[model samples]
Target: MNYERQPYRRCGRSGLKLPAISLGLWFHFGQERTLHDQRAIIAKALELGITHLDLADRYGPPLGAAEEAFGTIYRKDLRGLRDEIVVSTKGGNPMWDGPYGAGNSRKHLLATLDRSLKRLGLDHVDIYYLHRDDQETPLEEQVATLDHIVRQGKALYVGVSNFTPERTAEAASLLRELGTPLTVHQPQYSLLRRRIEDGLLAVLEEHGVGCVVYSPLAQGLLTDRYLDGIPAGSRAAGGRFLTASDVKPEVVAFVRTLHDLAAERGQSVAQLALAWALRDPRVTSLLVGASSPEQLEGNVAAVDRLGFTDDELAFIDRTAKEAGVLA
Candidate 1:
């Protein structure tokens, strides 16, 4: 892989520089996919200069399977390239049946991170994130646990995911007090999902916390996959996170308009969506998932036309609002 070809950005104020596009193992790395296929996807990602791999303990359909699958790939193919890779795993979502299966409690976080490390077959990860906030648990305790993980050398940096601006500010303040400032924030940001732009981006920028966004394609709705209609075997068809009911006729019409716009730019809707997310300087990287090598390659090419005209941005905003997809 020619690492120099991929653009790297500073993770907020951190010394680490992450590739602009990272491969996320959140989907299609579970039992539904073959091990060989999963390994091949990862191999293709690395060849495309995608150095960052994101995973979560609860990502797999059978919780924790994704990390286990990544562990196999890491030991077999990526062991020697460890220094060149930035592997991250998150916890704080339910992974088991017991009380400790989830949340930001010190016990859940510590135990899950330890188990994740063992599953990844690595002593330390580049970043460790509290997957979500546990309001029942004191914020102080959660931030302290993250600090503890960094001090113990289990993870090089700490981040938060699915946190609001107020919560992010509080966590950043606590981590800064402990001399381990929050490194990043993982939020869901896309043309369809604009909640982060309301205030989270400002909070991250003010606190110097980098942002790595997920669902940039809005679970494939922002892609050509849904431009015509819900394709068979699609995520929406599976009734998982997205559903057929969620794809209204008006939404498809709006997507067609966006698709036409993408064609004018010589890009796919997926590529346009990726570029749109990257347009914001506060976004350090995009965590994208791919089912095949070709898809991964196409996504990596989104960086080729990252810039957007003011008219394009305005049109997109107006169309999204018209379709009622704006959050």
Candidate 2:
């Protein structure tokens, strides 16, 4: 934990500042991983000045488990240092089998926030997000609910995730009308997934909303973990969300190129991928997850050296186009 940590950035025009590298409890923060492992990783992150910890209602093997685990950590290890951390949680992803259990309806979002608070063992969270756009629900209702969450003091700031450019723009406009500023937009963006670069980035920039992106490593495919083949205990081997079908020969060849580039820079592919994502000035933070302390340490170290030359960025763009991810 003696390594260098990067500077904090303003979340858009908001007065709040977030670390360049944030930790997401999306994976391995559940019953599948030991409590000791979770504590160690989180402890290491805190020691390295990674102040933000991201969570969601549907993050565990079974829903709600990750929040419960976080509650344990909050009460046991991090209770006294609450003010030093930024805790963000999302709802509206459908936790159960009822009509009202999902969507961005005021009923679903408000009720889910209460449950999320209980699970996190907190009176309020720093940020609460609408996990995804509820197409069925009108944009006005979604904005109102988010505004209400802030007004009630249950969440300090409001955000949205997995939303299209059009929807994001609409939500931003609505939130502006209500005087509740949209602080952040969480999306999946990486070298391999440049879909956001098309319009999403422009939408966010136009609205002055910051972005805290996820999957910058593309679930570990952007790393050397799959260079030769799927290791026995790799995420692809688990076959849950990512599977063997994802690790094709073409992907291996592409990863090899990334590996070579990273070697030339004396960094890991994971580090290079993160640096590339952080290059965006609108990207307020990078949400990363790790299964072990070693992985966390290595990933956090990437922040120590985050600069990329003009030639390197151009090369990455060309390689991404060649890989069919960008055009």
Candidate 3:
């Protein structure tokens, strides 16, 4: 892998640097996809210098399938490159049947992490996250649990996902007192969803924490996947994650306008969306999923034209907001 192919940014104020574009095993890394195909996507990502891979215990449709798949692929194809790669995983999502199944209590978090380590066939992961805010668990307990994990050498850094600005600030404060600063915050950000711009971005900036955005393409809404109407096996067509109501008449019109803009810029719709998401320097990385090597390569090409003129940014924002994409 050529490191110069993609740029790297510092995560928060920490010493760790993640790729501008990190591969996420959040989708298409389950039992439904073949191992051969999954390996090919990963191989192409590495070739483009995407050294960070994000995983979670509950990513798969069957839960734990993603980590299990990565274990086999890592042991066979990526064993020698362990030091060069930054692996991340999350817990605190439901993975079993009973009350002991999930949430951010120390007992569950540590046990969940131990199971994750075992599945990844590693002693520890570079970064571990509390998957979501657990209202049932005390804030101090959640923050201290993350610190304890780092102290035990089970996770080098800690982070939180899908959290509100107030909760994130509180967790950051608690972690700071423990001497293990919060490293990153993963939030969904796209032209179709700009909630992070409301308050979370400022919070992370004030706390010196980095942001790694996911769903920058709005789960295919901003991509060419729906240009010809939803295909037979598309996510929207399957009524999972995305639904028919999401593909409204006005939304389609907006996407078509976006396509024209992308074509004028000599980039794919998905590429333009990725570039716009990374326009903010505070966004250290973008986590994307791909089902094929070609798709992954196209995403990496987004870095080729990261610049946007003042007019372009203003137009896109005004148009998106007018079309109700900002909601």
List TM-scores for all candidates, in order.
Answer: 0.98, 0.97, 0.98
Per-candidate local distance difference test: 0.91, 0.89, 0.92
**Can you rank all candidates by TM-score, best first?**
3, 1, 2
What TM-score number comes out for model 1?
A: 0.98
Candidate 2, TM-score vs. the true structure?
0.97
Give one digit per residue, the lDDT tens place, for model 3 in 185-263: 9999988888999899999999999899988888888898888788898889989899978888778878888899999
Writing each residue's lDDT as its tens digit, candidate 2 over 251-297 gives 77777888899999999999999988999898999999998878987
**lDDT tens string, model 1, 1-327?**
768656899999989888899999988888889999999999999998999999998878788889999999999999999999999999888877788878999999999998999989999999999999999999999999999999999999999999999999999999999999999999999887889988999999999999999999888888888766778899999999999997878778888898899999999989999999999989999999999999999999999899999999999988888778677
Query: Which pairs clash in the backbone of model 2?
Result: none
RMSD of each: 1.0, 1.5, 0.9
Query: Which runs in model 2 stand beyond 4 Å of their true positions?
Result: 1-4
